[model samples]
Target: MSQSLDIAVIGATGTVGETLVQILEERDFPVANLHLLASSESAGQSVPFRGKNVRVREVDEFDFAKVQLAFFAAGPAVTLSFAPRATAAGCAVIDLSGALPVPQVVPEANPGILSGLGKPVQVGSPSASATALAVALAPLKGLLEIRQVSLTACLAMSSQGREAVSELARQTAELLNMRPLEPRVFDRQVAFNLLAQVGKPDAQGHVPLEKRLVNELRELLEAPLLKISVTCVQAPVFFGDSYSVSLQAAADVDLQAVNEALEAAAGIELVDADDYPTAVGDAVGQDVVYVGRVRHGVDDPAQLNLWLTTDNVRKGAALNAVQLAELLIKDPL
Candidate 1:
């Protein structure tokens, strides 16, 4: 018989949280009991799992001690309000909201750090762009001496929330039907058009998502001062995220070695050179990051470029958080 522990999932009604529940069931995680929680407004909803539907309860009314582990998948404010209670009750926490001022981790990039954490573990998951980059780059750290990484990330509408996702669909349908479009979630029209930026920009003209990528990617790669330039654009996509990455390695880069490294790496899928991958076709609903278009700079052998894609909500958020739980349970939860 396998050892099992009680688990609680915060924000269980959201897309990522629902996906988290689905993954837990699909992976056959040893869950003795499952606790679904959300805000009062979202409570009373039911999520299907393990051949039955689990009714959600309000987070404010639920006791953290009832579960050995809890996943924080809500907004930063929600995490801030309830995480302390869970931790105080000796519940291990995996925060996907990036609220806590902790080191962001990716299972493929920094699994070793899991064993060294203090008791009542509190871990933070990296952003989507960071997670994909870490999975693709961590394998090549030993192969190439990287000095700088420049990336342009095309993000899906689901990153903004369900409203944005619904708005994109509505706008697209209206345009197809030759009807006037009205943008609700976003200030401007987003259907069939790319948005220049993702989140609000600071005084330095850098958005939160871009800054998060630069910082989280460095942490995941264990390079505190690695130079990273990231630009996040809101694509007309609904589910997956795409990245065009260029790494400036010191001296000449061995293209064959890079290809082989990515091929052997866990959580990455190497696409054939003749065919490229897209967010919708290859990455959505997939757990691994797809890597293709592997080549060196047109004239500069020191520069390496690659294209990567992954399911933002699945692999990037829910599965990554769940993978951390899988590791934690091995050491006794």
Candidate 2:
């Protein structure tokens, strides 16, 4: 018989948090008791799980000892404050915020990293874009020596959380009525527009999101010095993430080999040449990373170009967390 475990989901009222709850139920994780937690503002609210309304309790007042595992979908502040507390209480923590001080993980790409980690593993989930990028590139890692990667990520407002989604919706409605648009969640009008910057730029002029993509890709792929550059843009849509990736290999690449590698990759759906995936039209609510538009570079057979899309909230965050949880369940640290 499967052992039932006690689980707590922090930030249960937010976008990724709510999605995590749905995925847990959908995957039928063996849960003895599920605790839904959120900030004081979100407390008293109820989220549906296993056909029941689980009332969200304030994280500040919750008891971490009650749960064996805790999934953090909250922002950095909440994670930094509570993750340690939960860990000290002997609860394994999987942080989806991408900000915690723990080993960043993508289960499909590197489940071996979890082995021999000692008891009560605490790990951080990769950023949504990093999740998609790593999954697409992992299959090729064994086939070709990837020297460099250049990517452009088109992210939706949902990446910023539910508030950003609401802001985009309000701006769209106001724009349709010809009313003045106020940019609240974003620095500029995000409705019917694109912003080149996703987060604040660093000393090297790389935004946090771009820097994170580079760092996480390296760790997930186990390529310490891989050259990677990414341009992140906030799209006008509300969900899903679309990416244009260019990979430069160390040796001459074969087109057929690349296609076969991608097609055989786990959690990747290769699209037909005549068809392509759109974030809103095709990738929403999907669990797999959709890859299409595979082609060789104009002059370099050693280089490849591919278009990829994924439901970032699911495969990128919640699903990845759940998969890691399942890994822990199968091979307890």
Off by over 4 Å in 2: none
lDDT of 1: 0.92
What is candidate 2's lDDT per residue for 45-93, written digit by digit as tens? 9999988999999999988999999999998899999998999999999
Cα RMSD for candidates in order = 1.1, 1.2
The prediction achieving the highest TM-score against the true structure is: 1
Task: Name the best candidate (by lDDT).
Answer: 1
Residue 290 CA error for candidate 1 (Å)?
0.1
Q: Candidate 2, TM-score vs. the true structure? A: 0.97
Stretches of candidate 1 off by over 4 Å are: none
